[model samples]
Target: MKTMRFTPPGYGGRRRDPEQVKRDGWREQGILAVSVDDERLTWPERELVRQLGDRLYGPRAADDGGRHG
Candidate 1:
């Protein structure tokens, strides 16, 4: 008898595609913009936007209030 471990597909921290990463960056930027400028995001949504911005650009990413190229 052999013991087996289940591993999900794309596991082991597979790198995200570059284009997908770029799109994600753009989406995060949009979310942060709406949260800060339009007051559109709920608390949780705003937190999520902040986290995404930190991940994509760094801590300062959200500081500009989503104004970035």
Candidate 2:
């Protein structure tokens, strides 16, 4: 399973690269997507994963599945 390191801004009082953060966040979401289905995780954990996905990717309409609608 792919895993993403949870390194947020201000880690060790250092500056961050926006582009890198975006890339990492996307990868993190992909990993979380798989992790969310893991039976080992509790309900709250799964909920948190869902919330993160929502926050990172935002809501999607049925017709807006990647193309101009």
Candidate 3:
């Protein structure tokens, strides 16, 4: 006689990356892409996206055309 053993699904599998998980969730919801200038995002969210963009890529032109007071 042979013994059969089964392990639970995803019990010993590699952990999924958090970023990938977020991307997957977005894909599932039909969110193909998001822009920093998207009006759907709140002011704070847009600011965060702008900061991330600066860190990942480089500084971008100010929306006010460099006018600061």
Candidate 4:
């Protein structure tokens, strides 16, 4: 036999997309947290972010420092 669990409202424990969260924060509250070129990330990490950004949100502008952000 299996037991059912009760989940509370707004507490479903759903994992959010970090990238979307960052974008939302920037768009809704003008908060630019953890950019692709924040200098804190390594080259590979930056490149991964850049690639994901490009794939998800299209390519970045040419004047945006080669889409490093």
Candidate 5:
């Protein structure tokens, strides 16, 4: 299995690059297409997608240590 890593562009407190954002969006669209065609995800792939979603849209609480001042 191939490994994939997702990093938000310019994630370390820098402005994101528009080209990188477009590339990432394309990658995400590809994943969505595959998921739709396959109709089900393998366990590991499912977990990876879940984690990615969390990174993208998860809740942030004060005690989670991810809150911005």
Candidate 6:
């Protein structure tokens, strides 16, 4: 959606697809991924959060930064 601009939805009765993805070519049978406002925050934002966590907590002694709050 960011690469190209789109017209307002339902302006001319053109609507979005019900299923975001098709399982035709995909090998995985059951996988659902939902993206919200995808244009915001790239990988750097996630990395920055990781770096800040390390800096504030000193590399997380034994934890591998896996647990989610």
* Top candidate, metric TM-score: 3
lDDT tens string, model 4, 1-69?
A: 976588777777877799889889999999766677768799998888888888878877863666654
Question: Please, what are the lDDT tens digits per residue for candidate 3 over residues 1-69?
Answer: 976476688677688887577688787986444578889889999999888888877877665468775
Candidate 5 C-alpha lDDT tens digits along 1-69 = 976476667555566686566667778775342231233677787667656655876833532567667
- Taking the tens digit of each residue's C-alpha lDDT, what string does model 2 give over 1-69? 977577666565565686566567778774322355568789998778766766887744532556765
- The per-prediction tally of clashing pairs is 0, 0, 0, 0, 0, 0
Task: Judging by lDDT, tell me the better candidate of 1 and 4.
Answer: 4
Pairs that collide, model 5: none
Q: How many backbone clashes does candidate 3 have?
A: 0
- Decreasing TM-score order of the candidates: 3, 4, 2, 1, 5, 6
**Model 4 whole-model lDDT (C-alpha atoms):** 0.79
Error of 3 at 63 (Å): 6.4
In model 4, where do residues sit more than 4 Å from their true spots?
1-33, 63-69
Taking all chains together, the TM-score of candidate 6 against the true structure is 0.27
Regarding TM-score, does 3 or 5 come out ahead?
A: 3
Q: List the residue pairs that clash in candidate 6.
A: none
Instruction: Assess the local accuracy of residue 16 in candidate 1 as a C-alpha lDDT between 0 and 100.
Output: 89
By TM-score, the better pick of 1 and 4 is 4
What is the Cα-based lDDT of residue 65 in candidate 4? 62
* Of 1 and 2, the candidate ranking higher by lDDT: 1
Per-model CA lDDT versus the true structure: 0.65, 0.63, 0.76, 0.79, 0.57, 0.51
Preferred candidate (lDDT higher): 5 or 6: 5
TM-score of 1: 0.35
Worst 10 residues of 2 by lDDT: 29-38
lDDT of 1 by residue, 9-68 (tens): 867656888657766877877522334333656778777777786787687654767798
Q: Residue-wise lDDT of candidate 6 within 9-29, one digit each (tens)?
A: 656664446453534223366
Ranking by lDDT: 4, 3, 1, 2, 5, 6
RMSD of each: 12.1, 14.7, 10.8, 12.5, 16.9, 15.0
